[model samples]
Target: MKSLMPYLKARTVEELWEYHTKLMQSYGFDRLIYAYTCFQSAQSLTNPEDALILTNYPSEYIEAYIGHGLFRDAPMMKWASRNVGAISWRYMWDDPDNTPLGATRRELMALNKRFGITCGYTISFPMAIKRSAAGIGLVARAGMTQNDVDALWEDKGEELEIINQVAHLAITQLPATGQSRILTPRQSEVLELVADGKSVRDIALLLGRKVATVDKHLRGARESLGVETTAQAVRKASVLNQIFIVDPGTQLS
Candidate 1:
């Protein structure tokens, strides 16, 4: 088991991702899809900014998966959503009661087979906060069977779990660059003060602006984030890593 501490401490998201991918490949899992969501709900499953997805799968396969709405029915995704810890796809098929996949989901699984995404383990990490979840799907290299992959996991599953947990934590700390809409400096400042529980009047006083101007900025932030309330705007902005960032000599009270 490689020590992921150095990678976990990486200063940049790209560096962390690169090292993590290399570590997975060293374990014979050459393809990986890692996703995390701070807001997971029945209605918002398709909300683009709520979830962050990183993958090394082929572009065509990814296009088809998203284009056909296959993620909604992806068996491993379903398994990850409700459970924690690592489980092989074989386990899902063998123990349907615990990790059931309906007929359509089974078809989706088979469809993945055509793309050489047949055998792998799905690792769902324990969520530390409500409405939050993270998971990784480790796809075995071509020609590997379930038995072969299972054997590898049996030998290294515990270490893999530890590695992935750290990796997830590292990923969440990274700025979600381009994954969500960029808020203006004023919008970010307003949202940050709002998150600190400041009222519009307080924010106006703090920034030496009029109450109307403060209210306009807040409203603009809500609209830009496609959210209805200031609280929602603050949360969405935080999830997008668009707020609470310190710039030199920038003060917020």
Candidate 2:
């Protein structure tokens, strides 16, 4: 792999994603889906809208996976959620007895098979925070079988893991500006103060606004972020890098 210093210094999430996708493609993984969320719960990712999803997967597949909320049924998603580090997709297919695969795996498997995405690998990055996680799925190129993926992985697995781990680290540091419009300036300000351990009255005092107005902003932020409370909004915004920024990221205006 080329020097990943450029990718580490990527100015925008889009730039990093583009570079990472191309990098993976060069190694024969033609499609990728990078997902991260701070709003993760014990069962689900909480909400698809809250996720930072960077993908080069087919639109039709993406539509079903995320748009139609089929990601909940995705076999790799299940694996990534439970474990860290890399795992081959061959395990699921090889296990005909379906000991590891779930009840919904059949449907998702059929969908993936239809799209020629039968072989791939999922790397679940380690997370320090209990409620946050990040992972990537590398779909093997068309006409590649599980055996082909196995051979490729055996040869280049170490380099691939290092590159992807670097990408994951770099990505988490960058602002997820794709959801920039999810909060207005006032809403973001309120959330930032909230994240700083400010109460409503304290935030109002700091922002030179009425407590009621601050509450309104907080409420708006929660609603916009699809969270039920201000604390949740703060956590979500902080995870997305929509709050507590020193140097703002790109395309956030």
Q: Tens-digit lDDT track for model 1 on 1-253?
A: 6886776567555677888888899998999998887788855354544677888889888876766777876767877888898988786455434555577677677778789887899999998778777899999988789899999889898888888889888777766634433678899998999888899999999999999999999899889878899988898787767797654255668
lDDT of prediction 2: 0.81
| Prediction-by-prediction clash tally | 0, 0
Kindly list the per-residue Cα lDDT of model 2 for residues 177-217, writing each as its tens digit.
Answer: 46545678778887877877788999888878899999888
Question: Ten residues in a row with the worst lDDT in model 2?
Answer: 244-253
RMSD of 2: 3.3
Looking at candidate 1, the ten consecutive residues that score lowest on lDDT are 92-101
Global lDDT scores for all candidate models? 0.80, 0.81
lDDT of 1 at 214: 93
Query: TM-score of every model?
Result: 0.85, 0.89
TM-score, model 1 to reference: 0.85
